[model samples]
Target: MTPPVYTTGQVVVNSGSPISFTATDASGGNRTAVFTGLTLNAGPNTIRVRGSSNSSNTTPFFQNYITVARASSTSVVSGTTTTPPTQTTISSPYTNSAVLAGGFAEGSLSDLLAMAPFVPSTNQFGSWAYGNSAKTVTNDTITIGWHKGLGGSLTILKDGSGPNLINNNASITTTYQGQTRRENGRQSDWAGYGTPFGYNQNGGGDPYTAYSPILNAQQRDSGIGYNWVAGGSISQDTSRILHYETRTINWDGGLRQVTYFKTQPMQWELRGVVDSTYRHVFYWLKGREVKVMFIIQTFRTDGQQKFRGRLQEGPFMYITAPHYRYFVYTGTNPTGETGTTGLTQINLSSPCEGAGTAGCPNQNDTGNWTSTGNWIGALDESNNGVFIVTPYNSNFVGKQFQSRSGDENSNASAYITAGPHLQNIDLPGTNFLASASYYVGSLTSFRTWYNSAGIVKMPFSFSFTPGKTNGWWSENVSGKLNSDNRYEINIGGNGGQGRFYSPEGSWMANTIDTIYVRGRFYGASSMTMNLQWKRPGETEIQIAQFNNKTFTVQGDGVERTYAVRMNGVTNWSGMIAFVKLTNPYPYGSFTGNEKFIPTYIGKTNPN
Candidate 1:
């Protein structure tokens, strides 16, 4: 069982030195924490300390890691010489019964993110995503604040220094975990309750604080809170703000690690529970390319063994995953893993992650997806997955457009559209308040349902009248366009902001896949978004042509009226679309293979 290497060493200044040290503990006493660079060498040193359980105790440490070999002063010249054995010492400390008042340093994590600042309310208008200026703080230091998306109310600003910093207020909010992941519309765990998942049916706003039950045992003791409230009225930027600094709301409970707040007006969202015992990991660290989602079940029992994947990148290049299961809506369900086990009505599998499409590599439909069983309930289980979060969060406010030196922001560098014409090009810039995701697939036809593999969603401020802008949008999102509710695919166009075609707008279910789109785009003038995702010449935007495939059609003739065809291009010319369904779906669609996969998620409207 050779596995216990806790080493700490140092001390050897001055020319005369002869130090030898060796400290080893083969877990016999198992209780290791050796950290030093101050004293651990002088002549003969072998100090190993390991203790546990009401017995042998010796804990004393000043930890002054002073590892300087031989020094005759004079900066020691030549490699700053500080060589050899002049000191040797080791002490084992074990008595941390509380009182380790150290304070956020070792990897400070931006000092715990300057006290969780993703400011969501200065009295309204919060949802950030800027890169032209997010720093230079000095005036009011609340720097930036805004977020009315997904339940609002996490405002900040203690010193943004405005008309008396919002008339001298200090900002205070602390509701740890729960309401942030898998939120199903709040109720308990104390500390200001009620108002968890705001509503308009999953897109409502307003209701920042109220219903907190006095820290209700820190919500079952998951720990991670820091509320310094008071943030609003900072002026200049013209709307589209959203900031949130509320963390430790249980860090997804147990073993903590749901850390997020992606710098400045950036963004964040990482959830949990795919567990079968460690395997669900999503790390972008800082290369940026995240867009993930979780929750899948058509039939599962929870007894996982092993899944699969492939892709290697050392200092960068990471896209990992390990599970999905959504069983219980049987029309006659029955596939592999043997079946049985009873009771099931589960529903929740899309609080996705991964903004850079770690590995969806263009999947319209293939095969090979093994373990899914991890939907067990109880505790508030109103249907798990945090009661069903909008697959994590869907905040895509829009109005961003630009075109310089040519290459298309629109109006033609040949033919580049950001109007639900293909896949949302940031959707025109104005007050900017996107995050309008969609997911209600059903077209009981001759079989062939889309949106499930490498999703492509877009809906920022969708609502255009005037004969539906003469183009028509609303895969059922509403804005008056009823032809039975047309929408096969239309990313950006028609309405104000709408993309991520699932009714079947984007094509090419074949090669060159890579689909990962994270949200956040508030603009007045920071435009230039193009993601044909491949529709120009490399050839790929085919489905009506019946190539870029995506299906779900279940039993019985599959239905009919299937006339699919989609294509798009920017640097030169090409645009086309079509979508019509009469009756389809009973079950038979869900293929993305693996890895924090998500196409879109937008929420906010509890107003």
Candidate 2:
């Protein structure tokens, strides 16, 4: 079946004009369709494709929006003129059943944290190559250590005492599709680490967020791996800033695109998705706060087949320490609950029993819990802590937070499970959206941003017209969206940039704001892009570089009324979006809400 095509046409002034669009089939092939000798319409001409699923095709499916706009400098000749179709305003409406409003405070890491210390990796930074030696000394304290190859690294201590006693090493195992993928550290380690067959961990010591303290390869020891090899390399530019690879392949041998950069001050970010499953892990830094965002779309199988999938397994923060106080929101916010999740701790009958009266841990249990308000925070008497917050929506419809030991209830190797999971047949695309933050400071500091809607929910709505700008001379360039909502923009007829601009509105431009571009690199080696803001008079400035990039802008009136553009220098394909935040920095650094639909019509953070 032909995939549904959603598009908006820019009516040209010339009527009976011919327009053409090229499409890529499921088999890595291209087909072009042209329309000639046609009468034009005056207003928005909407073309809606009946959405359906066809998994049998082995070829890539694409949807292209061919817009024909009149040139600004076109001459008005006296001869018979061709009038193109009028510009189309695309809109799809739905109801929330209940009045749901979301808001946030936008600002930079400096604006948020001021002078708070920020470090991306510590000895607790676990990894296989570095021999992540994370051990639980007691129920309230833990010790972690790693080797830099020159000699055994110091046994760095966490909230623990007594000569850093090493307990039985807790081995964390992760499985995907019923197969063991990894068996150490967090589930992300196993799921994201380089393949099991190779030892060269690419991107080792690479910081996921921006502005991390510059550390040599030995100290950093973080990297992204694919197919038993380092997908790419990490090099420090003349500015002393380290740049990580933009793309890699997963063990499944699927292309996983990545882009990251450290914003000024203390913020950093990593954004992109694996094209195959559309499973995305986005990282953003606001001050000392590092928020790891998760997103996944539901898939529909052939109906004849039965399949069960785990949307998110573990954002597990294994604090091998003892005497830690923990709490999970019970959905009841009293008249004066101080925190967003009501700040209620789960009283434990025993360290291994999890919540009080909540008996033995069951590994077989899916551990899915229903929560209208989602968040969990664990803190020791010293105030060192780990916290997590997840959206309360269909995307993250279920909640699961479990405190476990080495064995079922052994308490020998303690860890916390805090993520979403789904177990049902023919599951719809589950977004499983959530974020987690770690703080070495007081919970009060974490509470300020957390309580202030650090990760606020905003109603997303927009009519997007995807096109590219060629040095502001070409009327419009062409592109198409793949089945995954990724764009294959061909903007190099004469070497120009690919631009995706949001609809015009008074709220489009915000003074003293920041912009973020989340993109993927599909191997167009010479292609590059950066976020741009064009003033009313054609004056434009690059607000943020977009080569697997993200950035923030300061100062007022930089461009009060301007169009935001994601300009690419050559033919490129992947996911991308231009986001504007009212805060000098993206208050919470979570801006992956605008990928599926290319535009948004909601209030900005300040609004």
Candidate 3:
């Protein structure tokens, strides 16, 4: 039977032959079409009916049910039926004792303290306890305390009993061997000298408002307040446990506690809300390294808004036993230019601020300077230092560094200020999100990890528009997009090149080991291709001074993939802002119109 127009129907008999059936168009109600005189097999004769659309239109059709009956009996049999299996619950991986210890029950505080001193193979993940009725988490390197009496601000101590790293207001009197000696200690209360992350909505025109867990009377009057009023819970897994805290300031901003584990770093997820703007700060602490990330989100704006904010993680003071007197600036100038000597050093024993002497110039000397090199190291006489690496921040406008010399009376302090600096950023109708990351650790250890184990993925895509370069420019070469959407470059001259300059800033050079290039080489038997890059602070692009940079590719006119092994390149250290591919063959190697089509370029870590 022929199928109906715009509708389809099919039928098949078991073990014999297949047949088609026509379905009549029925309107408003249900209708049935029957077939007779069909032969049946012994046990179970399978019959199938299928319905489909005959036209390309996407209209749908439905079938309520299908029925089949025996010739002798009127009883119908509807397909096959089977019983479902039983459901069972799976047990949780976390132990009952671990859940209780990681929670906040009646006796959970004592249980949590007992599990605090966890020691792994590498380092000791110290302990957590109540100090002055406040919660404090301590490790071998530092102790961080928070809550009520501390003005709801985090107070950090070096090596548990050492001087305060967040502030230099510690003073105490001790008697030893009948001699009264006054010693420096943490402050009794962190009122004015509090390490709080806050923001100014009016572009620093008004005092900043801050959010804390529990604010004191003085803190409340001074723009510090708490939105959480109990109902915080803790949960645990095999590796780590999380403490969830709820808050409601100008908006609903939640807080989270650090996961206590030996292998993983302790991370704190804190949030703040002022007016319609919200900020989320994540702190990851392990040993001497402290990684901080700030996510700024603004909502309910008129059109565009201007604001100033900071992640005040430190006013880190230098210890007296080994005074940190040397300051090294490993960065570029305001215009992203590096001087003849990349490293700038100055002695911090002499106080300097806002562009001091020529030799001891600061960020103010460069007029709202931004560091493309992204790191600063402060060292003692023995080269034992603390380094702060900003890595790559696309949104950072103006960055400032301030340091004070140490004296017999006070310890030396160094801090950094990273913000947009009063720029009118375009806020798209009530929503905006921007972020920055900071890595702090010992200079020697940070360099080792930043190069090897701390690598991250860096992915970028290229465009094939004719005039729109999209941060990619051609020198001595003309490029166009072919019918297949591949960017084809015509070598106009001998030294033709195509380069991609990073539009945001410099990319972390150590993060990328292999650069995958997919394209074709045409019009010649073979050609020599060289991969080159510009390091951070470099104004001129140059060929990479390594043997691995030069590679020979066959011009078979077929598209192929190639991997540029930058790991073997010796000059691949430091941040990279520009990368290029050049045809380094002498003249007369091929026709000047020889085509080079590069379809894709990606940088990734294979390991």
Candidate 4:
């Protein structure tokens, strides 16, 4: 018989030779077609076959294999064949290096410096060495030197002594009591000193009694003040650097390097006075114009104890920049103090009463200072200064300036009373922590650098616990941190929302292009969840919204991950002041028991 013709689309072709075919019985009453009188090639070959319902309509073709034996043999092999699988390539907008450049991990320092705006000339980004090692941690702005003799204290150096210049300004020198004084060098002992008794020596309190983690006789007699440091307390074990690392962290906007160092657990004083362990973590991040230090203190007790006392000072930092003679306060000016609203300047040139005396010039600059809106800054004649930012949380209550001048030690220095004033309180095996940040740079670049630094270092966490919202708030919706570490929300009606609003503009909207949400939904009806945001200074009253349908499951309760892209949204620009999640379904159409549990919310630049 004539060979069957094959057709594709509108084209048809006939075989060159006549062929024979037969039908055979198969499983399930199916029939198989067999063909014969076909020539074969020696190696691999591709065969194309087509089937048609009729002459007018053609069905898609599939592959079949038939291997013929040599003419001397009498057998043939027949089976269905499949093309080998093709390798697929996945493409992403971001690279692995870019994504992990500033994140917290081993070997993240080199990646951070590769993308940093300013890099240090001497990069000592590694594990810290102890003992007589001369290893130092230097960045673009400052050098944290490891004292060779003591092998514990970290001396802060700037200007001439430091590695880089602050605002391109060189260190200045001046005369003080016929002694040479430089603008920048090692200024103070890196320690915290306090006492259970009152700070006043004449008010029936111990004169040479104070508690410090790194108290020593050498630092006490340095002439800043002999009375503030206790001689009996010198032999106490000083806090040693237990661990150090250069790691990256994902802050608000992007990744940045956080040089972290944890101190060994040490008692507050010589004897087991409080019977507690005090540990500290020092975080240093170098900015383009300023060097920032975050001091974190964690307290733990072996048992219940009472720390009823009058004065508790410490985490004190003394700066002896000779040119920084004027003390400036940026906050609500104290009633009888100096300067305008939100700004005050105090001259440290002349000595106050008891200037050279022990704890003479220690005064509360801001009466009952509570808000983060205040900061204590010391400015020089050229507007270059170093300022200590107020703590963001409720650990500190007031700001005090401890200065010394008009004595044999002509250079001025100050300390912040970081601890709260204790009268009588019981800490029952309680674990608590507190933190504060410091800046060293020129006054002209303060605001821009300060705001950027705050945004980059702002804390955002969703792994919540009971009664802790993690800076999140709700409106018309009740929510709680579940046992599984998920944030569960129950919506009662339409327009119910869960929000995180920052009036001070904590998020840089322009830097973030996508918001990643991972969660599970439980509901029968279809509903639309929206991601909304607002810009504080924008004229539009309505919040910007993006519909996200990832959580709209049919009561299956399956977890899903999705992204809400903000790059195309016109209003998602500038500083974002608010962000929230809401649904617009009516009450009767959707069940009020439609529960949603969100595990994480992250912002990034996916594109």
Candidate 5:
């Protein structure tokens, strides 16, 4: 039996040592005592061993014991014990602290979104191939569309009419809207709007022979005009006009495309077909993150291997990174208000505007909006909400891209710029990838989730909910980073109770009641439990009463509500209730010493 070299528990003696023991090993070998002196705690006669350790640091070798009075003799024996009224363990479905309940909520929502930096502007150019000549024309009218999940089907008409098809049906006129046709030297011809290449608008049994033309895919916003430029030739053989149409079907509660067609007719045929109409709009989901990806081949037609275009010339997805409901907390601009330039690391900031603030800054500087980095963030001035973002793919080098409000970049829209773009492609047939992720929540919660997930460096708080281990234990215990990213916790621990004070013996006080804790806890466990009122040079008090109950979480990853009220105790360290778990294995494993994580402690219930 190896002797225990270390001990964990609160101890204070008026005269003699509180703990006196012999150190030994399994092989009958004696080990030197390196144990430090302990400062005895006052008032509490009940003493429970929190943890114990051997020199070898073997698992399952530690145990918890209690100092119970023995009526038979003056000496007392160490044994298992239970001390407490009742402790109810609440199970939460929220796997990450960064996840929010309803994301964000408005006071009275008419056309309200619970979260902000709402869905991005349409990506009308996502699924289609890029080409020099536009090929998506409906009856000579240019059209583009994408399937929206649960929202509705979206089809835009480029002939200047807004989206013609929405919610799987036509909301606007389907008739062909007229658009100007630019000619080089040849006379223009006008033909009635026709259906797509193989469709017969007159309900005829015979349809035109099906054919497709090879179109050069061009970047959508790569400084190119949405019109056909004259090549200075009037000859029919020298001019080529492309047409496009979409065929769709009802799929999985959403619209799915059966096929998209692009066709060009010989100019000399003069069969009388109108120039293609134009539409530009993309798909977006409400209160959800946006992701866009497409494969781009660098080689041009006629077998040009290397891309001869400018390094900055490429079709990139345009999006807004809104800070409408959030404010920059950490990693902000030189002014410390909102992030005006692209950054590699940023915190969502604070002020998660539940509904919204009157005048919030939600734009970025146009000049450095497309800055390159791995992370970015925005703030919600309305309620101190934060919006953190990260690029999930390597090919996507742009992470902090955003749009400026009231600037020429966003056309004066209050949209923040965000999304993947093909900025520097000089290689041939190189596959460019774009991907990103986002988290919206309060500043403290965002930090906890971000640090625990090991995504990026930013302000972070520790989370102690039970469930699968998230690997944040090291940083949480070490206190490497802080909530404001301004200071750090340099004090080390015995790997047991959480240290709230700095190494200089300064305590950080938390006043929020109805706190939520998630971590492994056993019987007879005691720690400072205070909701408010922490005075200088005062020992924190423990909960006097505990309540046990069961609850069902509404949605996975959504915050729930819980109330902690003192049942039958007087001034028990300002504690309301004690929640404990019998089997802590479900949430995570513990070595009998690590402190519990107070996942969240607040006065307001997020639910």
Candidate 6:
């Protein structure tokens, strides 16, 4: 601080101080003038300000809140107050609730949303549709959605603010993309009128409407074919495969359609959608080495007709080619349900060894499980939680894993494991038919199985409790994914035990210390369970624990999905999965083959 009245604007030099200096002002170039006095060394001194405005460009003054800006950059450097960063937020155009509450508020929101509208999009490749012009999950991410059709015609499409849609029938998916265009390899050519002496390649006399001109009632050899390794888009769409096509035309029918026409069996393509979204069934691949295969069903959404001035060959069903990808559910209950934690379905009725002709996965159990055995489904998740299943195993303890062609894609499989509680005991153990009720998806959330009446032992239960938090038998076994790509739960037989209780007659509620059980499981893994379950299907592994406790659980069927990818490359073949265990630190668990690496892969181009 200085000792004199200093003014930063134009002022007469009547400065009073021990050492004074007069700063001139032009009011044009040097508007504000400064009068300094007693300017000794760099020491704190008292200074007074004269209220005045800097009349010249040379002088500048600031009052109240100050905002300092970078000298070189256009961004603000510092400000007197804090303001949150400006970000682009993604929100639905109109909340369903808001729309329901229509009023002035709705009118305002509608006006704001007027800038955006719902647009059709497609992803024959990915699972998520293009963002809705009126909605977006993120700049790149989208809420999974589907476009349904009237009656049975479904043309899968996505919608977003920017209005983007694509189909994967064209390129090399997400691979070989160095210099390739997304639209390069997606076109189809059906030889018809005007080509080759006005002859029709279609076996059907006249290109019919209800019938596709490309193929007659009977599937015959084709003159046109296309093949390529599936990737990002292919793998992502594993959960859903959509096929729909109309004309991309405007006011006057702007024409721009691709066509392929050659004599020798040649390959053609159409359009391309974005990459796919891959996920594991609550628990997907667990085998030492896993491989997935898929197929695409090409059919016409519109009438299959051929004429000089008509649309032909369109809306092909881009499916997962055989040998697609597999997701593996590997996490335990990230939630609180111990029973639901790492809960997976174990084939009780049949081991994953002899898949059905329609492609039902063989049971993966290590024991002698056959067509008669049942799936050891578990839902030991302490706090109740929901787990996903496939081809819902109706109480019919007979049918094995069925191909989800009706409700799920046939190219994928899932692996789930729950309840590390049940363990092995002696050959002679507690024998009872005590089963717990579990909730089923889409159906009854709870299903119960009672013991066969007329047993010798009285209804008196002895839930033998082991002092350990986690049980035994299952402890050292280290549940693992067998080569067959199924869970191997090892349990011994003998005088088994459980939390001895007398719930009905003489009871020991949460007693018997820690119950040693061989109960069933329908446990669910976390989202990290790298499984590739078809988006829409259900399966169950109803396991009967030795101690009369059968944990029968099921995953409800979700929407079906379709996708295909090449294993070893971007998910189709060369993939790395684990024999993951989900029991907390010690209690007891199986670590699955501790010394095995994924070595076996399905052979592509199989002879």
Return the top candidate by TM-score.
4
Better of 1 and 3 by lDDT: 3
lDDT, candidate 6, 1-607, per-residue tens: 1111111111111123222223222232222223345332222222332222334522222111111111223332221121111212322222122111000011122332231111223422222222211111121222211221010111121222312121223223321111122222221111111111111343434322211122221112222211111221122111112222222222112222111000111111111111111110000011110011111111112222220111111111221121011111223211222322332333333323335445555433222111101112322222211121111111111112322121112322222211111211111111111111111111112111101111121121221221111111222223322343222333211111111111111111222212122222222221111112101112211111110211211112121111112222221121111011122222222222122111111212111
Worst 10 residues of 2 by lDDT: 264-273
Worst 10 residues of 1 by lDDT: 311-320
Ranking of candidates on TM-score, top first:
4, 3, 2, 5, 1, 6
Clashes of each: 147, 40, 1, 2, 56, 144
Per residue, candidate 4 scores C-alpha lDDT tens digits across 440-552 of 66665665555445422233223322222233434444454344434466643333433322112235566777777666667764666666665432332366323222234
Which stretches of model 4 miss by more than 4 angstroms?
1-134, 148-153, 159-237, 248-257, 265-275, 288-315, 321-341, 346-349, 352-372, 391-412, 416-428, 451-607
Residue 334 displacement (Å), model 4: 16
Whole-model lDDT, model 3 = 0.34
How close to the true structure is residue 564 of candidate 3, measured as C-alpha lDDT? 81
Question: How big is the positional error of residue 33 in model 2, measured in Å on the Cα after superposition?
Answer: 51
lDDT-best of 1 and 2: 2
Per-residue error for 3 in candidate 4, Å, reads 95
TM-score of 1: 0.18
Error of model 5, residue 472, in angstroms: 33
For model 3, the superposed segments whose C-alpha errors exceed 4 Å read 1-135, 145-160, 168-274, 300-374, 394-403, 406-412, 417-425, 428-441, 457-535, 538-575, 578-607
Candidates 4 and 6 compared by TM-score, better number: 4
Estimate, for each residue in 313-344, the C-alpha lDDT of model 3 and write its tens digit.
Answer: 22122233233333333453322333323454
Q: Mind giving the per-residue lDDT tens digits that candidate 2 earns over 1-607?
A: 2221122223343455555555444344555565666554543232221211246533224432333433233442222111111212322111111121221111122221221122222222122121222221112333333112101111222334433211222233322112222222222210221111112332343232211121122222233312100111111100001111122223112332222221110000111111112222333333434434333222322122112122333344434344245555433331224543444454343334453345654222223332223445555555545554543211111112234333221223333444332221122221222334433335666566555654443223322222211101111223333344323333232123323433111112322233322233222332233333322112123343322233332212122222333344221122111222221222232222211122222233212
Give RMSD (Å) of candidate 4 vs. truth. Answer: 31.0
Model 2 whole-model lDDT (C-alpha atoms): 0.28
Task: Please give, for residues 486-506, the per-residue lDDT of candidate 5 as tens digits.
Answer: 112221233333323200111
Off by over 4 Å in 2: 1-182, 185-280, 295-311, 321-324, 330-336, 339-341, 351-373, 381-383, 392-414, 417-441, 458-607
Give the worst 10-residue stretch by lDDT in candidate 6.
275-284
Candidate 1: tens digits of C-alpha lDDT, residues 362-382: 111111111111111111121
Please give the lDDT score for candidate 1.
Answer: 0.19
Largest lDDT belongs to which candidate? Answer: 4
